[model samples]
Target: MTTVELPADAMDPTRDDRKSAKIAAGRVRPEPGAREVGGFGLGREVLRSGQMLQAGVSGDRFSPEDRFCPVFFLDGERHKKARTAIARYFTPKAINTHHRLVMERTTERLLGRLRATGTARLDELSYELAVAVAAEIIGLTGSDQATMAGRIEASLFATRVGSRNKAVRFGVGLVSALHAGRFYLRDVRPAIRARRAERRDDVISHLIDESYPDRAILVECMTYAVAGMVTTREFIVMAAWHLFEDDALRARFVAADAADQTAILEEILRLEPVAAMLHRRAERDVAFTGAVAAAGDVLAINIRAANVDPAAVGACPHALDPDRGTKQKQVGSFLSFGDGSHRCPGAQVAMAESRIFLDGLFAVPGIRLERAPDLTWFDGLGSYELRHAVIACTPAPTAD
Candidate 1:
């Protein structure tokens, strides 16, 4: 194994400098004269580089001539084309118009379940909500939502690319392929057929319109599913945990207007970014600010570090100040949703969904946090998830 020495604050992975769920926050601040580096300024530059390639199996597993990689990893003209086409659905107006109903309906269903049961795990509800909203936008609504979610997770768990269990991943390779087959057959093909017969204002329909083959479409459907559902669930739970523990913030969130409520959530996201690290491999030599990466070197941009960078967010970067975005020049969600061509297109969709769900959630009279969520880290995704966040309220009276 190789190691590089630097100041402890600059590279400690165990620093609990922030009490953010299970993982100790990362601080990759480069030491003076050290080639290894991280900061919002340099990180942003790295993301924007044309020489960068997505740095994981997901990117390198397939070639464009055979099958397209996930759109998030696409670069140059193809990437631009995909982003431009998908932009129609992610725009604020599109989310409010095409997706708001799905968001509201899903949130209402989860809250109704909690009201009836008197308690539920926050993560489960959030996962369901995330799945439904994302499925609707991606046009995976033809099959069972929960079943699709299970298939996606199961398929990923069977593959080395998405599985945390390194030992069993290849052993389960056949299982992963089978699960993927079932997913395509059960979830994807139906959507493709429906979209082909009559297009809808969704991603799959757009792909069909663009003549993407079935395998390519399935690749995209599954990619969007994981990106939208898995990560958003973690963010919702993490945000709720923070607000539930702080009465002032919860009250502020509930009382604030939509824009302000979103502002508050953005601050929470800034402090507890779900995806801690984003990797990129240098296609050629790259130089940014304080460092240089040679051709073929893989780089990891520490999102947590960049989000809390002193230069980007100003003094007290770690503090949860809702007004910090305006106080400084940082983006609303910080770098949590990422930046440049690879930036998350669903930022508004996530923010809008979170606000709608949380507003209804906090409004539950007598709602209480029964058990604090324990944190679990997903090594494959390089993210932390809150689990077993038990929330309860008085059950809706049994019908006579």
Candidate 2:
């Protein structure tokens, strides 16, 4: 490790002191070659690896050849193209039309469960609700939804921290469940064939009728499943938690006269964005914030950092003050859904689904917090899982 000392007087309070301290101490050493970021390596080291301008790399991370590299699972040009094709279905107008019914039914179902129980765990509740609605939209049967969700979570983020024990065992279980879902899909090809023979209004029928290639259709279906299944679930729970933590803000949202939920949703996304970071590997030497990233250099932009940047959002960055009195504050030019050519196509659907879920959730009388949930995130997985949360929604007391 190389270190270079700098003058103590040159401190800038305007910048993040920790970030500045690293650069001042020459702690920003670049590794020899263009390298990957944030995968089994130290997050800081991976971030700094992109600082090397001299390293030679193929810059192929964004190419179709690297599609399975985890980074490209949600990044790169192929994702962009895939998004373009998929956007035909996920357009704002289309999502508004198709997802409204799904959201309503899902909200009612979840609220029904909550109404029966005085208190319930929002973590499992929201995830299951989101997955069910997503599965229905993507043409998966009700019987398949729970199994598919388990599989997707396992395959996507089952990680082992060390050489031993129960976390690893649980991860193995997750992977097994995920693999089972894949195995189930092995018969899906014939299932699709039979479904094509019979008439249906689901996405499977549409894919067949539209004559999309089998693989392309499958990928699209899975993308919708993961995007809607995981992301929306996180949004619902996180947003509810946000409301629970801040009573005034919750009241603001609850008292809103109309159903325009975009502003409220935007603030929640900006404040504690469930997807904390977005990954990209340089296709060419790209300049960002005065740093030159060479080809093949993997960069993880901290959407959370960017969202809370004082430069971007002004002071009191972490505080969830929704009354910023402007649209820009709500969006904050955040990379939450990503930016550039590969922004999330399902954003509208996500917002609408969250609104419907929240509408049902808030309708319960005397909703009270039972326990603050643990929101600690697991790295490597590109989503959030709430460890636990319990809230009580009892009937209000009658007037004397």
The per-residue C-alpha lDDT of model 1 at residue 160 equals: 37
The residue pairs in collision within model 1 are none
Query: Compared with the true structure, what per-residue lDDT tens digits does model 2 show for residues 1-400?
Result: 1122222234233423111122212322222342323221233223333332211122332344533322225434554554564565566666667667777887787777777777788877788777776665566653455666776665554342322578876877676556645824753454477567784556666667657666555555655666777777767877887677656567777887434356766766776556655555565676654355677665655555566655555555554445422634335325567555545666767777787777678878877668867654444333455657888888444457
lDDT of 2 at 159: 42
Candidates' lDDT values, in order?
0.80, 0.57
Candidate 1 per-residue C-alpha lDDT over 1-400 given as tens digits, one digit per residue, 9 for 90 to 100: 1123334235443422244633544433222222333588888888888888766635667675443566776777888887898998899899877799999988999999999999999999999999999998999888988888888878776433544577766667777789999999999999999999989888999888878899989888888888899989988998888788777778788999998999989988988887777777788898877788898887777788888887897666666677778878667778888888888899899999999999999999789898989886766676776889999998899989
Name the 10 consecutive residues with the lowest summed lDDT in model 2. Answer: 17-26
Error of 2 at 130 (Å): 1.0
* RMSD from true fold, candidate 2: 9.6
Task: Provide the TM-score for each candidate, comma-separated.
Answer: 0.89, 0.71
TM-score: model 1 vs. ground truth: 0.89
> Candidate 1, 306: how far from true, in Å?
1.1
